[model samples]
Target chain A: MTQVVALSGGIGGAKLALGLQHILPPGELTVAVNTGDDFEHLGLSISPDIDTVLYTLAGLANPELSWGRAGDSWNFMAEIERLGGENWYRLGDKDLALHIERTRRLNAGEKLTGITADFARHFGVLGRVVPMSNDLVRTMVITDEGTLDFQHYFVERRCEPVVKGFAYAGAADARLPAQLQEDLQDPSLQAIVICPSNPWLSIAPILEIPAWREALLEVTAPVIAVSPLVNGQAVKGPITKIMSELQLELSSASIARFYEGIIDGFVIDKSEAHVAPEIAVATHVTGTPMKTPVDKQRLAREVLEFARSFGKL
Target chain B: MTQVVALSGGIGGAKLALGLQHILPPGELTVAVNTGDDFEHLGLSISPDIDTVLYTLAGLANPELSWGRAGDSWNFMAEIERLGGENWYRLGDKDLALHIERTRRLNAGEKLTGITADFARHFGVLGRVVPMSNDLVRTMVITDEGTLDFQHYFVERRCEPVVKGFAYAGAADARLPAQLQEDLQDPSLQAIVICPSNPWLSIAPILEIPAWREALLEVTAPVIAVSPLVNGQAVKGPITKIMSELQLELSSASIARFYEGIIDGFVIDKSEAHVAPEIAVATHVTGTPMKTPVDKQRLAREVLEFARSFGKL
Candidate 1:
């Protein structure tokens, strides 16, 4: 009857989140998704990470794209491009329903947490999905070109810009959602799993909110992370390139070092287990690449078992 | 070459507008579409009448529905409904591109006229398609239940409300688009054709603008209207029901009387020619049912020929 909380970003995080959802008992898992990449595009409020988690958990995610809805059409994007609207961030036709409905509810004064919960229920997601905060916390990448919004850098620019640094705009004022706070304080709370998403781009935004880090420190539950890097390369996305641009060591040791003070344990790919001696925390070497549902479930089981080894569960 | 300006609403008006586009030389026909029905739904600015005119003129309109794009898919609406969002308005997947693009440009400080014109050109529409004005002018339908916004009354309520009257919410301050004003004053302007859209819902919103009426009266060109009612029934929409509720006689003569002191000619269906003598304006009884492109062109030719009898063209 252990309750687990997972902090997630987009694709990679969503994969492990899906894994966690499948392996965990009903109502035992809760996901706090990054909203730092949320932006208003073409007048619709688009929450990229939240939608990825929703689609992935609901089993509606496009397997080929690893984002958006399955069996999705591109009529909206094609027509938008024809009309000279920005088409860099592709919005699938069926996927647009989520953005439009979320935007409508947000404009109608509904909180993001409530809206996300409602969407999860509507889509038949087994576990709870909550936004990290109701308030704005945009991730701004200070690149060589200029300060670009997270989506502009990651999607529009295709991560082509050399990263100087990142700033979590509005993080100073953002409060952790009450749901997340209450979950963290629950008596049965056993573990906090940071999924294999980019540390700086995904997990950092959640951690940058001062209260979030403070809350994690206060929790008795063992905080653990699955490394996004395997053999000094990202399993997906631009994490390796970003690490190189920021002049950080491209290794699992670097990831462990990044979360040194917060996490009690780190999960890295078995191929790179040699670097475990340099990690400050307890290290678990496992098969971390989640290509199939079986892979996700297996990793989820391994992570939970690893967390249990800390004498909490 | 004669230049004609047409005032239109949705479906019916779009039919006649399409006919005008076919019969008139390229760039000779300009449509001033009613924006009173424009409302923010799902956070997207939906100019229904403007889009209808654009789709009809561009040959993308559905012959079956006469409103949305041909071969349109309803995945967006279906998904929106599944998500518990509003589905009564029925925005098709392809049609949503127009609304999303327009909403984006409007938020970017572009005029509705410019955006619409750009869309028209993008869609390969030869004739100009512009909104009646760039400013907001919502049509509020006063019913026995209470006042309802145009879309609420027409789409959500299914035109079931007992109509009392209508109020153009922002008509007093709305200015005619510069393009419409310039077109009206051009020496080559020979006629202003009022298409067969519901006078209460469509054309009236455009005509309700005080400056619009004043400018129309000052023009040397003939002002003509195609009757929406035929033989005590509407060719489409709720014209007959609204007329009965408003205590007006259900006849083509009543339509002519509605535009009294504004129009110099009225085109009605030949089936109702017996009531022509009661009309104050010059009545032209012809085959006005535009079911096909050829039919639209024929009606357009006849209406133009009838307008020329005023000695302007």
Candidate 2:
């Protein structure tokens, strides 16, 4: 049974997932990565979030850019740009192979989970990396410009469009991977850590799946969420901008409130510690900006210790 | 009016094609590259010969390696190997973009000819690059082991399999692109140059196409072939090995004989000048190994000058 299950989107989420995997025993962690951000570009199936988690756990994450693989080359993108092909979504040279291989496997009738897990093994990642679901769960951004595919809205448009709301296009029909479902039911499972990622764009896509949500809800393990924001600002990505655009309060309490019925505990940054008292469930405050290895490990330890204080929900 | 139409496969063919394109008036030369070597790999439509011609004419051909784009990175193939992918067919990082973009455009319903022309323009190529046919024509190699796809036989197996014969799947059904049909019919067209690519592997696929061969034969321009062999040896690629395996005489006369009734002229090497008498058509002998820009230009000039001496038959 997996001791820790961290669920969230790319970059930021991958950080915490790496920390958990490192601190836990080998194979003790399961990082259920959001596949909503996956899209077909230039006839390639790209799962950005899943690759982030895989790269991070494999110690291949690009420390310079805080995303993609370490030492990843951009020759592929350069040639794509030169050829007047789709150049908005950047694909690094080394990273391209993974996408191509994954797409090939998927086309060969293998599930995304199997392909991801196999890639994780090949990458020498310590823990398992699985997609939220085998089925497509596109995160469609309902922006003022128009409804856009997640990549088109986020990458191509540079998230410039004013947000109205979001939708998980295939979430209603998606089912949790059978192994993941079985893992969630295991009593040895300690907690579900929803890492600091975009709530509407990343976590919600996974949550919108009725089967996954019900299975997660049935699990006795406490579900904890770490605030993606520090000092009421996102450590990375467009979280704060999205919140402001959505007319939501720029505070950790607002983030906690969004997961009201789902999470058993919430961990905010020291800057937003004041808002913790306003939360209904248990809450903890810590410095959550994961820049270095120590930063990630410290935060991971803090989250785990926080979860230990409460009994299984 | 197009001055020259060169037909052949990769590397050796691309060398002469580059020479013709460089010497002729910009856009006067047309390169009809073999699509028989094209195949769906990693779900991307890969046109090996077309890309070779495109890269060669664009001043992007790898000078040292003599294939793919210049300064092409291998990180993609390296990572593919690491991920246990089908890495036998080496796809350079820069070359990958062409395959992907071509595949994407094809999926969007664009014809290969239109894509090739557009790619040629984008490459700043002096000459027009074209597929022999818009339809898929896969070259299947019959070997001692079994039948193998062109790429499988050429790249994966490294041509170790003893060749029995070859077949161009879909060649009979494929039609000439309308623009090419019109180009061939143009009264002002000059000679057709058969580049020094393998007669069986490179030139045969195009010849197998009924429409293209018929249109080519109906043209008033003289049809001439430049020997891929010099000193009874291939300048590049598997001509000698395949010829020996297929039990054919490994000489320029044999190459010219393969094109029997279709050609009015042939060019052999100075070393193979003796065999010129065996060929019925007008044969020109010169140092045909294209090592430098001067060599390519010299050969191109010779082929055109020879064509001009003859009346359109």
Candidate 3:
């Protein structure tokens, strides 16, 4: 009867979401993905984080590409480029179906929550995957080159622009999706696992939402955040670079500090065990590098065990 | 330099558009395609007739499929079906590129005319491919099953429903694209060739536009129409069925009668020579069956010669 709510971004977070989905029973885990990275590209409402979680949970993600559908072809992108279309944000042939369908449904007055649930059900994904909010909430990255949308800063520029700050546009106005509010209020809920995604770009946007933040602060369930950093560098992506650019310490402790008031415990890699004492909340030192299937489940088990050690068991 | 303005729909019309492009110098021909067949599919603006003209002129059309880009894959459609998305109207992988780009540009405030011209330039199309108007004009087919959108009636239902009537929604209010207006007023404009396409479904949409019709009616150029039928049967598609359903004779003379005042001459297949005497307008008997590589060019020459014979030569 245990239920969990996991917060995730794209690629790296999806890896952890995959781990948790594998460890938990079907319909038990609820992955609330960041909608900060969602943008309108070629008239498509692309929820990068939501799609990653969906693909990861459904086991449709390409192992090599790290995102998008498995065995997806580049015929669509190739033709777009040939026709002088914007090909920077490549939508693979198979991957494009999700964007198109999602956009279509969204345009037809369906909420993001319903569409995500429907897509997951179709793909036979274990557990539930929901967007942090049904309302529009975009992450605008303030960089040396000026403010750019999340995808333009990330995918189009390859995260090259030096980060100054980030603005969670519409987060203040964005309300929690009804189902997520009900899920958060459920007395049977065990813990909220924050996946190892970029804290500023991924988790911050979700936490910035007033209703979502208020729900997490008021919920009885333990909220645990895993560090995206291994030691002083990111496992992948520009987390380290962005952290340094923002004049923050490049360590798991800094990441733990970022989520200080919101999270109950912090999970860091065993390599950063020395920083465990620095974290104000209870800490779990585990092998968080989810390279293999065993690694993901092992890390997931350890995190849950750590949460249970706080008198819940 | 002979300047032509060819009116077209899709598939069957594209063949003659290609033939005109092959015989005429680059930029000498302007294929004003029907916007009636155009619709928003999955939030992407799809100009079926315009794309057909573009592909045919660019030599990128699939010879086997009679539609879509050459060697385009169906991975996108397959994935859409798997995701429980609408798959009735199939948009191929490579073929989807144009729709996406055009949709993007249109949302960004670009006109269909500019986008079509840009796409044609990108593909190195010999002749200009332009939508009939920048404004929207959708075809509504009133059938026994009810009035359905053109694509829903044609692609989804495979034109099985009995035809009752047709409506060119927005056609009356739609104005001709500026370039088309200028082309119509050109002193060197030799002729206007209406390609062999469905009269009610294709040409009617373009002709229904008051400004476009007036331009053709008052232009100092010859207007010639190519019969879509061989004897009493269409070369491809459900033209014969729709004609019979509409309580009209399945003959080329009936088609010529439909274009009575607008067209100066009618080009019929040699097999339909028997019906030529029945046509009110001056008639030219030629090989209208554009089945072979030579057939298209040969038919193109015959139509052009027929047009030139009316004082232009």
Which numbered prediction scores highest in lDDT against the true structure?
A: 1
Clashing pairs in 3: none
Best by TM-score: 2
Q: DockQ values for all predictions?
A: 0.78, 0.85, 0.83
lDDT of 1 by residue, B123-205 (tens): 99989998998889999999999999999998899889899999998988899988898999999998999999989898788
* lDDT (Cα, tens digit) per residue for candidate 2, span A1-313: 6888889799999989878987999988999989999999888899999988888888888887756889988998988888888788888999998889888889889999999988998989988888999999999999999899998988888899999999889999999998788778877888899999988888999999998889777778889999898998988889988999999999988889989888999999899988878888899888999988899999999999898888764
Question: Candidate 1, which segments miss by more than 4 Å at Cα?
Answer: none
Q: Give the least accurate 10-residue stretch of model 1 chain A, judged by summed lDDT.
A: A76-85
TM-scores, chain B, all models: 0.97, 0.98, 0.98
Worst 10 residues of 2 chain B by lDDT: B179-188
- iRMS, candidate 2, in Å: value is 0.8
**Residue-level lDDT for B25 in candidate 1:** 84
Q: Which candidate is the best by DockQ?
A: 2
Which rank order by TM-score, best down to worst?
Answer: 2, 1, 3
> For model 1 chain B, where is the 10-residue window of minimal lDDT?
B228-237
**Candidate 1: what lDDT?**
0.90
Q: Each model's C-alpha lDDT?
A: 0.90, 0.88, 0.89
Clashes of each: 0, 0, 0
